[model samples]
Target: MNHTIIISKRISIYIIGLFLLSLGATFSILAGIGVSPVTSLPYALALTTPLSVGITTVLANFVFIILQAIILKEIRWKNFFIQLIISFLFGFFMDFTIWLTNGLPEATSLVLIIVYLAISLILVALALLLYFTANLPTMPYDSLTYVIANTWKIPFSKAKITSDMLNVVLSLVICLLFIQSFGAIGIGTFIAAYGIGKMVGVLLHKLQPSLKQWVYKNN
Candidate 1:
């Protein structure tokens, strides 16, 4: 394939991934799942800062990229720019979805929450699907785990487990601070998040080949 053509194709897949990520985020929030690591930054900021969640997300990701650059020193233009664009896109869609769902009737609210959970779980699967479609850098969180493992000469699986545990603990802390002390977080949020992420990773791997091609060609 022509190099330019390949680049274009990858960008298209990334756009699709961005939409899926944004919708997944909406589902996560509505399902009351523990907030995603990156998303948690915005949630925390929302407590004290007057900024919107979407803006806060972009700001946090920018800071994260800077930190990664300083620490790893392998920050490439394509990967950094692509991640930034996708984060911005996801944030936009997330805000839209939240607005669309916030006004549901009582029964509708319950039904929507169930739908949110189901979609949130599947979104993780879709994420893996979308990830392989681009055949590019994994998400930033995964990339960090890889670097940490490689630098420390540890097994990738071990690194992944530790990273995930860190997120889990961090989520718990956020829940404690917000729902327990500050009184903002809710029940079932962290549990749903942790469970759905694991379930999705397992389920997605089984269907990776087909999902990868579909997300690549169809999207």
Candidate 2:
């Protein structure tokens, strides 16, 4: 009974984490400065195509899952299914958050931009806290970084950098060729690309112990 309760609690935290992640991403998008690195490609695609950013995010994540399968040469079918479900939920949460905040004042001034950026970073940090603590089926984009690092015998940091750079490059290409707009790739994109990880790390260092205590109190 204790084990089951623990599992249920963890699941709840994971779901909340995913929701927060989507919320942060939405803030970044609506900020109109730019998006985070992970969402950069999808944002670019959405700007050019008729698809909404949420749908594009789902499609992009699916592609990442496929890449993980190819790289790992095996698929954990159960975990893959869980990831798919989570991805769908993430996409939905993003769309829902966007809709919820649609009436908020426009992000026009430098102050709003900074506020949005700070909010995004804090939310992302808290989301990461829940996500890593839950220890659930990994998100495909995150899994890909692990697979690449393991397969290539490189440092995980290097692998992650490469993956991020590739996504940024793809986002840039799509914007240049199809959209002819750079609106989605701005200072915010660069900030997210270079700073989010470090910020998450700092947050983790400070918060992980308290979070662990809270979640594992019964253990």
Candidate 3:
């Protein structure tokens, strides 16, 4: 019963995290600035193609899972399938959030854009921390970081940095190729690239004790 309760709590937190994650990303795109580095490609693809950002995100994350298998030279069929399910859930969640946020007017003023970006970063950071605390199956994009680090025998930090840079570059290429302009790559990407980690670190530092009590221990 105890274990079941723990699992239930974790799943509940994970679902909340997933929804917030979608909300954050959607706001970033609609802020009229660049989306986060991790999301830039999908944002660009969504702009250039008929597919929605959510659909592009799902397809991109699916590729990440495949790339992980290729890097490991081995596949855990169960984890692969779990990640597949998560990818779709995340995609659908994003679609719903996009619909919900679509009613907001576009951010135009510099201050408003900054406000939007700030909200985006904060939600993403907090959502990721909640998701991690839940100890659930890892998201495929995040999973690729450790996969690359282990495969190359490099530190996780280096792997993450490299992965982010590659994502931004590819996003830039996609924008240039398809749209003939920088459609979804902007200053906001750089801000998110650095800000998200710092925000996450700050949040974890501030909330670790409270989270440990409520999330991982007796509430």
Residue 154 of model 3: what lDDT?
A: 98
Query: Which stretches in model 2 have alpha-carbon errors above 4 Å?
Result: none
Q: Where's the lowest-lDDT run of ten residues in candidate 2?
A: 210-219
Q: CA shift at 27, candidate 2, in angstroms?
A: 0.9
Q: Model 1, 147-183: lDDT tens per residue?
A: 7788889999788677655654554565466555422
* TM-score for each of the candidates: 0.71, 0.95, 0.96
Which pairs of residues clash in candidate 2, taking residues 3 or more apart in a chain or in different chains?
none
List the candidate 1 regions with Cα displacement exceeding 4 Å: 1-9, 73-78, 105-112, 167-194, 212-219
Could you tell me which 10 consecutive residues in candidate 1 have the lowest summed lDDT?
181-190
The candidate with the higher TM-score, 2 or 3, is 3
lDDT of 2 by residue, 73-113 (tens): 89978877877887788878878888887987888998998
RMSD of 2: 1.4
In model 3, the runs with Cα more than 4 Å from the true position are none
**Candidate number achieving the greatest lDDT relative to the actual structure:** 3
lDDT of 3 by residue, 1-219 (tens): 766777888899899999899899988987878888888877888988999888998999988999999999999899989998998999999899999987787898888898898899989998988888888898898899989998899999999999999988998999999889888899989899899999888888888668756766643
RMSD of 3: 1.2
Q: Highest TM-score among the candidates is held by which one?
A: 3
TM-score leaderboard ranking: 3, 2, 1
C-alpha positional error of residue 195 in candidate 3 after TM-score superposition, expressed in Å: 0.8
